[model samples]
Target: MATKRVAADVPVVRVDGRELRPGQSFQGIEYRGKDKDGNDVWRILVYAGDKWVETPDGKRKRVVKTDKHTFTGTFRDAKKFKAKLEAERQDGTYTPPSKETVAGYLREWLDTTARRALRPSTHAIYEVNVNKHIIPALGHIRLQKLDSNTIDRFYSSLEDKLSPATIMKIHTILLSALSKAKADGIIKQNPAKNATPPRVEDPEITVLTQEQLDRLLETAKGTRIYALLYTLAYTGLRLGEALQLRWSDVDLDRGVLYVLHKTKTKSSIRAVSLDDDVVAVLRQHKEEQDEIKEIEGERYQDMGLVFATERGTPPSPSNLRNRYLYPLCAKAGVPRINFHALRHTHASLLMAANVHPKIISERLGHASIETTADRYQHLFPTLQAEALEQYKEYRRKHGKGG
Candidate 1:
């Protein structure tokens, strides 16, 4: 009833309206067919370079084409291919707002919004949180597609792995990034707005007893690093802030240290009185630094940093911790607490000494008095006992017996 169909490879491919040369590659094929109504239908078969591709519904599809061509396949096959390609094209059109990840957004937010508006020390802390925690976990996720569920899962996983304080830091970073994204219209919603950070129950702060402090000072004697530990424990300066200090910031005559710049907290900028012992140690340190500068000759940069390397250059935080602090603590036979613990010790000692909470708050440069009170609330019983004793003394003076 019908003539035999041509063999499957009988040179059916055409190029530029002519039969293709033998052995020439069939870059693609094109054809036209008539339906029952005799309407002409056209389609194109694309070569590798002729069309662009995209993924849609987890499948590959052709999104764009360079040239139009006719089709040879059945209508059903043609329609299916066209639909898949269209889906891919449409999906490609729906681009996320930014190409950056969650971590990248945090950096951008800090540079654009925080650095200009917030204090320098505050910016530094945000930078730390972004680098140490947030980027490592969720930096690869696209900003627009980062939904609440994704953030919830990230938090849940962090809860199992990190300390509560560390988890809280991660949450703070995410909240800040999402808030900026919302304000900029990069995201339609703030997924982190309702999220709760991990609860950080206060732990007992360790303070060096007077005897231990004396032993530490004795052990540190005759070493240049001793001045570093003495400064931290006696003055309560943070390690970064201490490292950033310049000789100019010290007021030896007035026995005061001006903390105008800190490498840790934004609120850690205030003047503090120095004890005589601390002043003496600093004076000795300055003399040692000057001698080293003389030895180094022109190599010394004279950066004016109080805690500097032998070359008179500013000391890096890591190098100072490894080379000086850790080794000195080990030699002193004390538990190897990090440099930050020195700050805790200072606060704890002040609390133990019954310093006013408001004064402590101002000295530490905390954002609010409430934060200071919350941190040292455990010392209130001591304050309360002192108050009761004062009341008894008043009663005794006024002839009101117990």
Candidate 2:
């Protein structure tokens, strides 16, 4: 007689040993026996893939499979575990992991999922970090073996070699990849869950003072990049956004510019109200562009870009920075910040003038007002102080003070 009766429902689990590789035999437990405590326990068996082993030891150890796994112990905990395993199998969202390494999984994940899901530039960045940083550092480790402690040590080693910002980017890619692995059931848990990456240091925003702005603009007068740089300063436009502007998007009479195209983010699409002075500068720029177009005749590439070279092509950002903006900044004796500082200068001037963050966010084409506040959080306390002072004066006049 059988020692114990098998239950109709059990979680079928497969835990294989190493002997299956050579094709001489296979090794695993067949869920068909009872332990000394009268609870069912698994028994080991060998197979040749689909065929059962007929050797004396194999036959003695073997038992039949009925799509059920052995279970024992207290009714509650065992039932819960069995249900979970069965649910996972039925849903097909997960499976037992085969022999795979972390590097192999990450490469496949990037190629199959991240490459198409992320934006082109973002994918390029992920590719660089994965291929250069992550795979090289921990590729040999098995997916199951990776742990938060290992990742923490890796981050610690990189502390002195990479900036906090770059390290954070690398960590973000690893976390994302590992997260996908967990979701796919390739691993039981994501090792990066509790991993500590270097905290990103707040970047020092380079905002040009009013005096510096005056000098830089004055120095840029009559220079090729004057209009481009001036528009950025006056309108709080990001460098890439300013470069992508077109004539049709500008409404000089109404003093408005439609941001129909942005080089970086689609969320930045919105209309921006331009200052009267900025409109005048753009008008002058348009006239100059026409003159250049006439001079170049058929050779000019008229793609309608607002900021372009004499040949009507959009000027390379690096070329414009090195050949023009930097030299002008040096001549003006300013901090010599890059073209992006002009956008910062614009936002700072607005804040100094007591403009609201929502308005600044719109002008700068930021994705959200929170982005503006976070980027300029250091300036916000000063704004609060100024407002309180104004409130105090109002209260004094109303009756509180002589």
Candidate 3:
């Protein structure tokens, strides 16, 4: 049934044995019939004060603004909401109802604020989440109509189809986008702050032992991606970081790599030292690349990427995974692991060798040593025992043992 505005002459409506009337907080509360479940629905009216509006002739006129919020709960609930609306209006953070759909706003946000502010890869991720997941579920709803309850329900609906980690990523996108909308005064507040998302526990990290690493490298010895895999094992560079490396970024003489772009954080944009073996491997790879460039002549892309396809074009991750990584792991008889496992293998091996955690942190480009310690906390006790054993060995050598 449609709801009509309550006139001043209407009889008082008794709610919970209390007579309700217009007061400082609300102008009136109307009983808008029961909902589908037979619960009384009350529409609370509040004075939203005055606002300057433009007329058809382009002249500004001051007009009184009023707000009606429909609530499907007890009388106390309606009163509380009325108070909240009045407070929002007084503070100038009240968002009037708008017809802007969630999909329209999110797509605009992705094209404008997110494009210039986020890295290209990050922007692509946002675009995918908005189009593939978020928009399909909640895009048709008005921007201002989005509430915490709606978001909570949406997250629950995705539980069967997506992993908790993937759902968490979706939550992050929504929270970030809605926070921007709030900051821009498009919404009164961020509803995402109150919505609950699934908790994602850190997965077990898999790394190869020295023997396994040897077998994997041996299997990749003569392959085109050999140098890239070798660099990952020796330097612990991320797959993206290693793939995007340029000839200018690598210093063979100094045995160092300058990571300038596509990094996860500001701390990731640091210099990483290379092992002598890895440096030599890169030198040979460079020679091989130069010969290919001469053979291909003008067909070569000349992007200067250190790890590229035969035509000097950047290699896709899928190609690296499907064509090389999987086959090499199978042939080498090692456990099939993703590219990131090589980075873990490198870090774990260094820690096993009694290298300082600070050095490991810097090498891995971690934001802080604490991050390294937390990530590899499982290995510290053994390292500590080894340190004590070394102390005993030193004492024995000096003839000061107990």
Q: Highest TM-score among the candidates is held by which one?
A: 3
Worst lDDT window (10 residues) for model 1? 1-10
> What TM-score do all the candidates reach, one by one?
0.64, 0.72, 0.83
Candidate 3 lDDT at 96 equals 65
Cα error, candidate 1, residue 34 (Å) = 29
Clashes counted in candidate 1 amount to 4
Question: Which parts of model 1 are misplaced by more than 4 Å?
Answer: 1-142, 159-161, 262-267, 386-402
User: What tens-digit string does per-residue lDDT give for candidate 3 at 1-402?
Assistant: 222225764323455555543332223677665567856577777776788999999999999877667778766677788778778888876766567799999999999999998989889988998899999999999898899999999999999999999899999999999999999888888999999999999988999999999999998998998999999999988999998899999899999999887798999998999888999999999999999999999999999999999898989998899999999999999999999999999999999988888999999999999999999898888888999999988888887554
Best by lDDT: 3
Residue ranges of candidate 2 with Cα displaced over 4 Å: 1-94, 99-112, 142-145, 262-267, 296-299, 367-370, 395-402
Per-model root-mean-square deviation over C-alphas: 12.4, 9.9, 4.9
- With a 3 Å backbone cut-off (N, CA, C), the pairs that clash in candidate 1 are 31-70, 31-71, 43-70, 43-71
Q: How many clashes (backbone N, Cα, C below 3 Å) per candidate?
A: 4, 0, 0
TM-score: which is higher, 2 or 3? Answer: 3
Ranking of candidates on TM-score, top first: 3, 2, 1
